[model samples]
Target: MTTPRYKRILLKLSGEALMGDQGFGISPSMIKYVAREIRSITDIGCEVAVVVGGGNIFRGIAASSYNMDRASADHMGMLATVINSLALQDALEHSGVQTRVQTAISMHEVAEPYILRRAVRHLEKGRVVIFAAGTGNPYFTTDTAAVLRAQEIHAEMLMKATKVDGLYDSDPAINENAAFIKHISYMSVLERQLKVMDMTAISLAMDNDLPLVVFNLSDEGSMLRVVCGESVGSRIDNVTDGKNRVDRTAAVSESYH
Candidate 1:
């Protein structure tokens, strides 16, 4: 049994990651896969907290571009996150992992209101806590919410699970020559305007010196490997050891299913 590098971590999942091969909505298989991945780490005694995005169902920013009220669109988006959160909780429970759903916005009928101490307590008792509703406010992405919750819970690291292997200089889909970054500095990420996360989230993590790992969730056991500190993805921190450049030769492609 390998000792985990971080006792506690915040795992951030994009709504898009739940869509699988479908164009919209959550894929049952994908959600289950995510649950199992989380369970793998939790079984090793690593406390887990999740922050999932809602872009698969609704994107407030995209709506706002088409004459919709930004706040209203964002509110809808937040609700979408809650939906995902509930689905995730159900799947986690089915996987034999005790789970809790806490929403930033008050909605006691379904989940507990986002109470910092209570959420921490749940994690301390070996329960996986899924944070939903995205900060209970508009204009903030789930990325920011993940960072905020991680800080409040004192997570050792923020692990962002994505479809791709790691951070890249440009969108790999569009740019054939895009380079894969193995490691980077938060400030450099901001300067380059990388899309690993929103600027606000990156800035907050940088300010608090929170380490971030961007890895491919589609790869089996990738999450567990990351928890064991196995260099499974690109890492972003405050260090600048001249190792921030991308490795154009390194690329990984794996099927989600």
Candidate 2:
């Protein structure tokens, strides 16, 4: 059996990833696909915890931009995360992976309240723990919540699942001339004002020196490859040896598959 790179990891999934080809809301097929991907890692004895966003259902920042109260909008966004969490829980359970949903906001009826010790216990028992509700506070994003939970659980690494194969100098979707960055320092990301993560989340991860891997979720076996220590995504950390060096040549020549 191939040994996994990290014993424990935190995966951050954007709510938009759950939508698949749909215009809005959760897509059952996407959730099931994610469940299978997660199960692959667990089958190899890797402990996994996830933080899912709710942008597909509701985006607090966008709402606030349209004249809604910021706090109320954020709270509503948190609830959207809860809904995503439940859907994920159901999918995981159906896939035969034991799962638990922990909410930052207290809602005992739907899930257990966020308790550090219990969450650790659940992972120790081989169950995947899904954190929802975005830190139970207003003005915070799921990105920040993922970092906080990862630090609290002492995860070996943080994995961010995105649509892009890796981090690029510019949006690869529109700019074909963008350069691919294989590795970057957290400070470089912040200084360059990259969209890898929100400033608060990047700052928090930087302060704690938590390594983050951003990869394409749509690619089959991408998560498994990442867990197995393959160069499956762009990595961000404190390493300064070759930080901020863009790979324009690799961008055109290398294939993620």
Over 1-257, each residue of candidate 2 has an lDDT whose tens digit, in order, gives: 76898999999999999999897999999999999999999999999999999998999999999999999999999999999999999999999999999999999999999999999999999999999998999999999999999999999999999887788877765666878888899988998888888999999999999999999898999999999999987999997685465677334322221
Candidate 2's displacement at residue 232, Å, is 0.9
Tens digits of per-residue lDDT for model 1, 117-189: 9999999999999999999999999999999999999999999998888898887766667788988999999
How many residue pairs clash in each candidate at the backbone level? 0, 0
lDDT of each: 0.92, 0.92
Instruction: List the candidates' TM-scores in order.
Output: 0.96, 0.95
Regions of model 1 farther than 4 Å from truth: 250-257
Over the full model, what C-alpha lDDT does candidate 1 score relative to the true structure? 0.92
Measured by TM-score, the strongest candidate is 1
Candidate 2 residues lying further than 4 Å off, grouped into runs, are: 249-257
